[model samples]
Target chain A: MRATVIHAPFDVRLEELPDPRIEGPGDAVVKVVASCICGSDLWPYRGDPPVKQPRPIGHEFVGIVQEVGFDVRTVKPGDFVVAPFVVSDGTCPHCLAGYQTACQNLVGYGQGKADGGQGEYVKLPYADGTLVATPEVPDDALVPSLLTLSDVMGTGWHAARSARVKAGDTVVVVGDGAVGLCGVLAASRMGAERVVALSRHEPRQKLAKEFGATDIISERGDAAKDAVLELTKGVGADAVLECVGTAQSMTTAFDVARPGATVGFVGVPHGVEVPISTMFRNNIGLAGGAAPCRAYLPALMADVLSGAIDPGKVFDSELPLADVAEGYAAMHERRAIKVLLRP
Target chain B: MRATVIHAPFDVRLEELPDPRIEGPGDAVVKVVASCICGSDLWPYRGDPPVKQPRPIGHEFVGIVQEVGFDVRTVKPGDFVVAPFVVSDGTCPHCLAGYQTACQNLVGYGQGKADGGQGEYVKLPYADGTLVATPEVPDDALVPSLLTLSDVMGTGWHAARSARVKAGDTVVVVGDGAVGLCGVLAASRMGAERVVALSRHEPRQKLAKEFGATDIISERGDAAKDAVLELTKGVGADAVLECVGTAQSMTTAFDVARPGATVGFVGVPHGVEVPISTMFRNNIGLAGGAAPCRAYLPALMADVLSGAIDPGKVFDSELPLADVAEGYAAMHERRAIKVLLRP
Candidate 1:
């Protein structure tokens, strides 16, 4: 099978790798129908020193089960399914509490005996607990939407939920990436009365509105904070979704929240140190981590299936599996909001 | 009027100062009935650079309103009241949302036209919002309990509430000082099934149990963490109340929380920086600030008036106004859990 592999920084290749097998009794071999490059993938692709061993790339996918190990019970061959980026036993205390990402026996994809979700065929462990099967094969048009349930959409939901978004809330989304756009959708769907999307890019700003942004701020840093504060009548927003994990973005999220408001962040954090005293004095509530995507898959899948949401619109480009390198380039060059790959 | 003054580090003196009077439409002059030396007083009294002007000390007290500016409507002369350490306008959005401490027009006690609560008379700003009136004059025996309602007890309640303590939660109070003992009481009152108090002080450990600590751990730092983990079947506590503002206490609070648990902290933070990425990944929630004591005042007052709780036990020593310096010394030397002063 050909899969996306990173040999080093800025070097992505579609390499011929040995096909995956169901070695674990709870594993299933999936024939991936669609996969998408993620923002995190760009971390290694854009000049971070790579590991000595080639790394498998991508974790978001929608696929059909080609085969399952003898003990796999919940899902079987010929079923269309979506696997959350992280696999959990779904029986541990944390998983039972709907924080599957923190499950004691959690296994992240693209590692261990499993191949990347971007591959033509991949082995998914804990098949019974990790895979969510659709009632039947989804319409080809809904494949992109289903693929998002694997991570980004679930993450967006996590951000909104963590912030405790309620009806009549004024929400602020701090980034305009695909995840940020999805946050706008999630906040709106969660009944936020007003959602302010921050963006300087005209294209993303337009898409942001389509995804339920009631307002848009083009400035960055202090100026952006001023705009949000002004729009909120100086009270600040009731909920803030931090989709970018930089210190600047985190600070803005904290600054733009009402005294008792919460900032729900799902961005992969890096080098962010929060001054606890400031948060304490301001009465700001900070909640969110890696989204327990598995916990939310059931509900979000229903929304996608019923056409209540169209998060797939964020996929602005699509390419064949062999052209996977170009897919990364398109996102890296800002030529695509998100790239979908057909295997 | 006599008041405790900090002329220099370790130089607490009972000084003769001009009596306070109502100076604004929103002001009231309160004749203090009882005031307690707080842990925070030691900050300025122990080696902090002194100002040219002597600083009036203390922010915790129960008092009687002696006079009010014409516009002060909530309480009149002869009303016994408890003032939150911070005064707020009460009409701001933050105050309406139960975060009075972060009110847009926040005026901390002891500043502006007001003197500290420790003085014989204090000119309080935002009188209606800052002072909570008791049904009548509280009994002399209840003076210490009522005084605690002004700050420490209210702060402990804030910590328990911020952590979202539920009926079945196992709570850990991470300090054994007066405030920490109060937190154990708050958590237990909030219905935590098991309350753990961490302290190495034998006397404090005894008081912690009387205040509702089901378990007491005499270990500090890592050893304390191991004990808490062992007690919780290695899952850590569901809610942790951080009553000490030091880095060591703050870190211990985080270390003993279960995944998806919350840490409620109320001590005035001195040098605490939180590792956001680690908190993000762990799904730990951090909440609580300067207590918003005014918000919790009414409910807590009812609990005290009905004799349902007795936080006055923390005031193990008492001093006359002239011995104010000795009161500070007793607390600094740990010879008293809390020192009550009468002017």
Candidate 2:
């Protein structure tokens, strides 16, 4: 089997790996049909938090179940399934409470407990809990959108949900990445009257507009905040989605939120400092993190299949599994918003 | 007239000051009927952030409106009123949005814009916005509870509201101060199935029990977190109230919160660092800040007026207005949970 591995910074490679087999009673072997590079993957790749050792990488994918252990009841061999970025035991307290990302018995793809999603096949535990099957395998054209249900789309939806976006709200999205673009779509679909996207990139801005961003601001930092405040006539945004996890992004997210509004943050924080005084003084709240994608997969998958949304447009570049390194490079170089890989 | 002023650490004195009179169209003069020492007052008294100069200090008081300017419409002379900790123009977007603390024209008591609450009289602007007048002046026994509405009781209610305390929740309160004790009351009123108070002090624990605490854990730090988890059979509390502004208190607040729970914090953060990674991993949320006390005043005042809640029990000591110095000392020395001063 061929899989992706990162030996060091700037060195992701497709390497031959032994075939994965179901090792637990609740495990299933999945033959990945599609996978992709993520902005978070760039963190380790760029040495922000450098890789310590060579390891399997990639956590988002859609696949066909090739084999299933006896205990697997929700999914079966030959079922088309979408796997959330993390696996969880279905009946754990947190999972039962709809926060599978914090499940007591949680497993991450690419870690030793589960095969990397960027491989030909993945053997994973908790099949009933982790995988969601489409009603039927749809046309090949729907693969990209369904594959997104594995992480980004659900994550974007989580940001909107966490921010408590509602009808007639003015929402601000503070990043232009695929997830941020999807957040614009989520807020708009949630009935927000105005969706504001902060983006400097022309391509990403175009996608943002298509994703239902009623306004776009090509500014950064304080200027971006000023633009948002100006757009809303100094009232600020009713809900803010902090999609980029940086100190500056987080600051702007808080700065542009109206009094009593919440900043729903889904980005993995990197050198971020929450402005406690600002949040306190303005009565603004901060919520959301490491979105529970599994909890959102069912409804989001339905949205994708029904053509209510087309988040697959976030994939501006595509590559074969063998060219995964180029896909990583293109994304890192900012040449692609997101890159989808076919196995 | 006499006013309380803080010249330095451990030095609070009631000294002669000019009598206050309305100077703005929206202004009103409030004759101090009752004022109280707050935990926040001890901040400048002990001088964590050292007081720069001698300044008037108190912000919580119940009073009778002495006079009102021509523009004052909601309150008038001879009316018994409860003044919120801060003065805000009621017509601002934030104020209209039910977040008076973040009102565009916000004025803090003792900040020169308004006379210190611990004074013979307070001349403040935005009378219609900041002062809530009762239908009629009630008996002296109701004075203490009504005074609490100016700050602590409303702050506690804000914490519960920010945490989104719903029916059937298991709530945890992280501080044993007046605000936290009031939070127990707030959570109970909101229909939490269980209200847990982390208090080691016997007096506070007793008050907590009276205020609707179903469980009391006199543990600190990790032990406290462990105790809460054990109480919930390892599931953690559904909502947590962080009423101590220290780093340790904030940490424990997050530690005891179950995944998907919100930690509603109302203490003024002094040296707090948010646990972003922990919040991200568990999907825990942090909300609430310098509570919009004015917004909550009307409802909480009704609760107090009806004798449904007696938050005034938190005041363990009382002093004449001239002995305001002793009130500060008693509160600072931990000899008094809270001290009420009669002017």
Candidate 3:
């Protein structure tokens, strides 16, 4: 088997490794059919938080169950399944409450116990709790969309849900990454009358529009806030989805929210300082965090299969698993919105 | 007219002032029947944010409408009304959305346009928007409860509402002041099965228990968090009301919130730094701010009038209007939970 490993900054390689095998009663081996590079992977790749040692690296993927332990009842070999970024016991109090990301017995993909997702095969625990199977393996064309349920699509949906986006809301989506684009789609699908996307790049803006962004602001910082306020006729957005976790993006998200509106942020924060005074004075709320993707997989998977949404468009570049390094490079350089890899 | 004025820290005086009169089409002059010294008033009294000059203070009061501009419709002369801490037009988008605190034409009491509430008479704009009148004058005993509706009760209700307290939830309140005590009542009224109060003061603990705190944890800081976690079987409280705005209180509020739980904070934040990373990793959400008390006035008012709640017990000390300085001193020295004043 071969897996993606990060040796140091800007150094991701597909290296040969021993094949994975189910090691626990709740474990299963998945033959990776599809995976992709994520923006977070860039955090270490760019040395923002430099890698300390060589380790397996991906956490999103969809594949066929190649083998399953005796205790795995929900899925079996030959079943197509989507694995959320993290594995949970599903029976823990948090998981039972629909927050699998905070599961008491949680396991992260590529973190020793579970094989890295961007690999030929992944042996992971808590199979029954983490993997969601499609009703039936559908046409190959639906793979990309289903693949997204592993993280980005569900994460985007979580942002919209967290912001409490409702049918007549004017929603502002900050960030034009794959997740933000999906957020635009999620808000629109949730019946938001107006979905605003803030993006400076032409390609991302076009994609954002395609994802149902009713308006696009190419400005950054205060100017972007002004544009959103202008678009909403000085009322600001009813709900704001902050998909990029940076100080600037968070600030913009809070600034453009209307009084009493909530900013649902999903981006992993880095140097982000929440404006407590501003939020209090404006009666604004901040919600959303690491999305519980597993909790959303079933419904989102149904939406993908039913063609109610087509989030696969977020992947503008595709590569063979062997060209994984190029995929990482393309994403790091902003040459690709998201790169899909075929195993 | 005589009003409470702050000349400097530890220097509150009751000085003779000119009688107030309706100054705008929407203005109303109310003859205050009862007013209270708030926790926030102590902010300036203690010089955390030093008083710059002699200025009328106090923003919580219930009064009889003495005079109204021709355009004032909802309230008229002789009508008993409860005034929210701030004045709003009640017609702006934010106001119409039920966030009167953020009204486009918001006017705070003691700020030029609206006369300070502790004064014998208050001339305020946007009468219809800021005043909620009772059906008719009732027994004087109801005066205390009704007066609380002006701020603390409504603000406490806002915290529970903001925290999204639901039936059967285990709610934790982090402050034991008037507002936090009210929060205990609010959560219990909302059907929270377990209402926990983190209080060390014996007087407040008794008041809190009377207000429906099912459990009392007198520990502070880390011990408090451990107590709450232990009580919830390490799952944390389903909802947390952050009634005190200090950094330590805010930190504790986040620490004891269960995954997927919301921390509804209403205390005016002071030097509070939000733990964004912890929130993101645990899926704990931070919501609620200054609290749009006006929006909640109607329902809570109805509850008070019906004897469904008794928040006025929070006023542990009473003083005549002429003793305003002593009232401020008592509150500043923590000799009073809240001080009620009679004109």
TM-score of chain B of each: 0.97, 0.99, 0.99
Cα lDDT tens digits, model 1, A1-343, are: 9888887777788888888887979889999999999888887787654546787878888899999989988888999999898878877777877878887888766677567878898887788878999999989999999999988899888899889899999999998888899999999999999999999899899998998999999999999889988998899999999998898999899889888888898888877777576778888888889888888898999999999999998899999999999999899998998999998
lDDT (0-100) at residue A330 of candidate 1? Answer: 91
Worst 10 residues of 2 chain A by lDDT: A108-117
Candidates' lDDT values, in order?
0.87, 0.93, 0.93
TM-score: which is higher, 1 or 2?
2
lDDT (10s digit) by residue, model 3, range A218-277 = 999999988988888899999999999999999999999999999999999999999999
Instruction: Give the per-residue Cα lDDT of candidate 1 at A200.
Output: 89
Where does candidate 1 clash, by residue pair?
Answer: none
Error of 1 at B47 (Å): 3.0
Q: In model 1, which runs have C-alpha deviations exceeding 4 angstroms?
A: B49-52
lDDT of 1 at A52: 62
Residue pairs in clash, model 3: none
* Deviation of model 2 at B217, angstroms: 1.3
Can you write out model 1's per-residue Cα lDDT over B1-343, one digit (the tens) per residue? Answer: 9887788888888888888877889898889898888898888888654545677878888788999988988999999999888778888888988889888888765565568767788887889878999999988998889889888898888889988998989999998888899999999998999999999999999999998899999889999999999998877888999999888998999999887888888877878877576678778888888788888889888988898889888899998878988998898999999999998
Misplaced by over 4 Å in model 2 are none
For model 3 chain A, give the 10-residue run with minimal summed lDDT. Answer: A44-53
